[model samples]
Target chain A: MSSITWQTVQAEALRRIRTREWPPGSRIPDEAVLAAELGCARATVNRALRELAEAGLLERRRKAGTRVPLNPVRKATFEVPIIRQDIEGRGLVPGYRLLTRAVEPAPAALLASLPAGSLPPGAQLLRLRALHLAGDAPFCLEERWVNPLTAPGILVADLDGISANEWLVQNTSFTGGDIAFGATNADAETAAALDCPPGASLFVIDRMTRAGEALITSVRLSYAPGYQMQAVI
Target chain B: MSSITWQTVQAEALRRIRTREWPPGSRIPDEAVLAAELGCARATVNRALRELAEAGLLERRRKAGTRVPLNPVRKATFEVPIIRQDIEGRGLVPGYRLLTRAVEPAPAALLASLPAGSLPPGAQLLRLRALHLAGDAPFCLEERWVNPLTAPGILVADLDGISANEWLVQNTSFTGGDIAFGATNADAETAAALDCPPGASLFVIDRMTRAGEALITSVRLSYAPGYQMQAVI
Candidate 1:
């Protein structure tokens, strides 16, 4: 209402806090003192402190005053991951090595998850077993199930230098899916493949990616337990 | 997949894992072997193993095999919180006593972020200083700002009976927010309110809540440093 400036005053308060001119744990100068120093009304200081407190940078209390906070816990947020992008982001050359690929009769249940139609001529299932390694050691062993009705070309898709993670994130926008996270022990195969001993712990993530009304892919990823999903929160 | 005969296979696998019949780190019979034993086809056994792996009970490898997991680190997840619910969820009676509430001139920036008028006419900035206690001592001191435009009748809102958190969750869906988590030393007021001596460590969550286009509410939550948030990731 006074046509008085706000940003300058807010900026001044922030500067004082950042510089520790008002050291944390110590109360900021009282309203009258801050008002005099800032050449503004107490309402202006109130606005500034209120905003900082909202930002988890300061704390306000009655009978005492406003002070700086020490640790901010929930401030950390989750970093959602898209694997291939994550690999490249980590400065790695992302490549997919097809260790085994085959087309066989569809498992009955898998076929049932599909539309209720008679199996096409030689309506075989395509099984692609691949190893995703950061450099030399295997990073993940992917056992993915793809529906031919939805992604027919995937049976012969060129995947030598690309990852399903990137390819999917690029070519399609799968609407939804369920994600499950847990821990398990690596069997002998996973142990040898991932270079860990049998019974070693591994972080497991099983996700079923979906489109509007279609199931796109069901993937199972096993990670060495040393893997960490750290978030600031 | 096969006449629901697969459910029995899944049940048997689950029972074996839990009973340690398939002892942790021990290899499980492969599809062909397991199918014969379970009186089902290899496909059914594969399905059972697939679900078990998905559930984190086993890790199936191509040539290796499936084995039980020992330590399920168990995923932990944390959702941003409303302090009171956070406290109560921890088995504490979330108590809030408003120390002060009134309509005051909106600070300039807040004024800009609020409705199209000067503190609106009857509008007043409601400042409520509340004490949140655990069992006997103060757990958190919440100093919140509520805009009358959005939080109409704020002056008469009954917060003593219900926590600000449960109410907000039921009453509104927030658009977005920014949170900063950090530690802070308690001041004289915070010290007295939280029953801690000055300079004691405290966890602080400073955050802003937005509704659609306007800044709905801003809150500062100060807690004892021992406070921890645990979630099933």
Candidate 2:
């Protein structure tokens, strides 16, 4: 037996499998039993089984018991983020230009999503809208809102140079948030910016953040389908 | 001296913004000054600014200081999960299904993604193509795999009435994983399964999971662009 204990159990599991001793779909011995057979602790066996389940090798449930998989694959999840970093990471220049910026009354949905009674009566929410471009192609359309009462200074920034992403990274911080993601048939406004027709599919993100005790920001982001976010850990 | 505390700081900030007291692109007070003014701690002010930055409201850097957004609204991130539960929390059936199952050799990319030399040579891998139907329509098409060496008993499962999601949940436990999400142009085969044309964009999730000491599962999940997972926190 090799000095390393866990690898040995993994090897034995494979050995038993290749010899067809356990057979397919038959529940393997429990952790306690496997430990006795392997001359190791139940923890080692548990670790091996846990890893296998994550890799789609085995399946287990509460009170249901564990077993080998017939077709042992599991679902994959990917992360999505801003476009400039996306382009630059591929060794390309990140560029941006504001499409529009205005201060308008927050929408009803925006209002509802916020904590009740965040704004004083007749508060005109500061709205900022812009399009992010990558290599002359429109990559995203960003529409965002700020509670002026929460953030007193929002009206004067150099919009021609930096993106909100870069600005935020360089200027402020994000502590915690609740975020949502979806795929949608693009609406007319997004279609116009993305150069795709309305009803085209788009990836959408909506989020709200609280700065400790302060409600800091609320935003809606839209991306042309095919933009992807990848994070390796 | 208000009941809201941080929310008060945030609400007042919004009011000041609406009146242009801070203006667009103007720097705001630091944590020390703001907390003193707001009668809070430096940590609390930091929290508010950090949140505002994420919401695309403020800009601060190591030396630059915090300021109002030219375009203060930022992209909000939402976790992607299931819709029925999201809708049904207001009460609805969180329904699901199984579409198809097959066994095929692991693809070259998939093999590379899997733990090298884990399986004995020339083992015909198990591939299951299952559709997750929510209510009556196709919600997701899950194509998964299984390594017989990991769990030998999977071969006996008659998945006609059962789902891979439910079956796997009933069978295995995993510690954690690496997840990725992005938009991809669909290939011919995947498009047909999702009912979209080849070259149309599909949201893709590519992830790998670890059991205990081994890489057990790797999968690519493709969804029609209109599918969005929403969450609240």
Candidate 1 scores a C-alpha RMSD against the true structure in Å of 23.9
Across A2-41, the per-residue lDDT of candidate 1 in tens digits comes to: 5445566666776776566765566777767877776788
How high is the lDDT of residue A185 in model 2? 63
* Top-DockQ structure, candidate number: 2
True contacts kept of 2: 0.33
Off by over 4 Å in 2: A1-83, A165-176, A195-199, A212-215, A231-233, B1-91, B107-123, B133-138, B169-177, B183-204, B210-215, B222-227, B230-233
Worst-scoring 10-residue span by lDDT in model 2 chain B: B78-87
For candidate 1, what is the lDDT?
A: 0.62
TM-score against native, each model: 0.36, 0.57
| Candidate 1 Cα errors over 4 Å, as ranges | A1-77, A91-93, A104-125, B1-233
Q: What is the C-alpha lDDT profile of model 2 across A146-201, one tens digit per residue?
A: 66665545556676677655554344444456766665666788889888777665
Q: On residues B1-233, what C-alpha lDDT tens digit does candidate 1 reach at each position?
A: 34547678898887776556776678888789888876788877876777667545578788887877543222223455556656767888766666656557556665554445323455456666777777776877887777666654545668776655445544444445565444455678887887876756565666666655665576777775356443332
Which candidate wins on lDDT? 2
